[model samples]
Target: MEISEIQHLAALARIRLTDEEAGAFAAECDSILAYVAQVKEISTGGSAAPSAGAHKNVLREDVETTEPEAYAEALLAAAPDRDGRYLRVKKILGETP
Candidate 1:
């Protein structure tokens, strides 16, 4: 991404950075993207890209029974208000389609 694009992204994220910090991050992004582009220019000979470490799908048995009520209780404890089973949340309009 361009430096301006990076700055725009930071703004969207509500991150406040000094001009020098934004420029530094932009340069870092440019270097990383240049490296990626250089790699992409090479032909992989129809082979998959190298994996840093080979990892295969891990299979595990389902261990679910019933979640303890204490689990829900802990989460609800952080809630401003909760009705029996669910937490009550404030409604904010205009984002949903």
Candidate 2:
């Protein structure tokens, strides 16, 4: 990576870097890219480490249950806001309400 390339990348990432930092990062990025290129040259179409076996799925069967009314009421009482039986939480997306 050149200093200009590093400066461009820093700008795109919204990071502020001094001239010294940009120079240092340019060298580091160049070294990393060279190492990656070397690794790519040596890699074959097989895993470097041995695999134990094929992957297994261990999910349990889903079950449905209903809580008692008193239990549900206790939970609602601990919330910051609520509307009847539903919890009223702030919207995470779109414009604020």
Candidate 3:
């Protein structure tokens, strides 16, 4: 990696690097690229398969239940403050009607 390349990368990443930092990064980048090049030189026999039992989706079926009254009752019961049949939460958005 060259200093110019490092500067270009820093600019693309929107980062500001000192001259010393850029030189250090250039050396580090060179080392990383060398390692990647070495990894590419490795040869695999082109056989890829699952070693253990096959994977299966463990998710439960989606079943929409209509129980608004029960859900509203549970929600109201959990509220710290409430009016006769509605929750009385603190005013969060500007002035209320």
The per-prediction CA RMSD against the true structure, in angstroms, equals: 5.0, 8.1, 11.4
lDDT of 1 by residue, 20-78 (tens): 88889988888888888887787779967677588888987888666667477888888
TM-score for candidate 3: 0.42
**lDDT of all the models against the reference?**
0.81, 0.84, 0.84
Model 2 C-alpha lDDT per residue in residues 3-22, reported as the tens digit of each score: 78888999999999998999
Q: Name model 3 segments beyond 4 Å from true.
A: 44-97
Pairwise lDDT winner, candidates 1 and 3: 3
Better of 1 and 2 by TM-score: 1
Alpha carbon deviation, residue 77, candidate 1 (Å): 3.6
Q: What's the C-alpha lDDT at position 57 in model 3?
A: 59
Highest-TM-score candidate: 1
Local error of candidate 1 at residue 65 (angstroms): 3.9
For model 2, name the residue pairs that clash: none
RMSD, model 1, all Cα superposed? 5.0
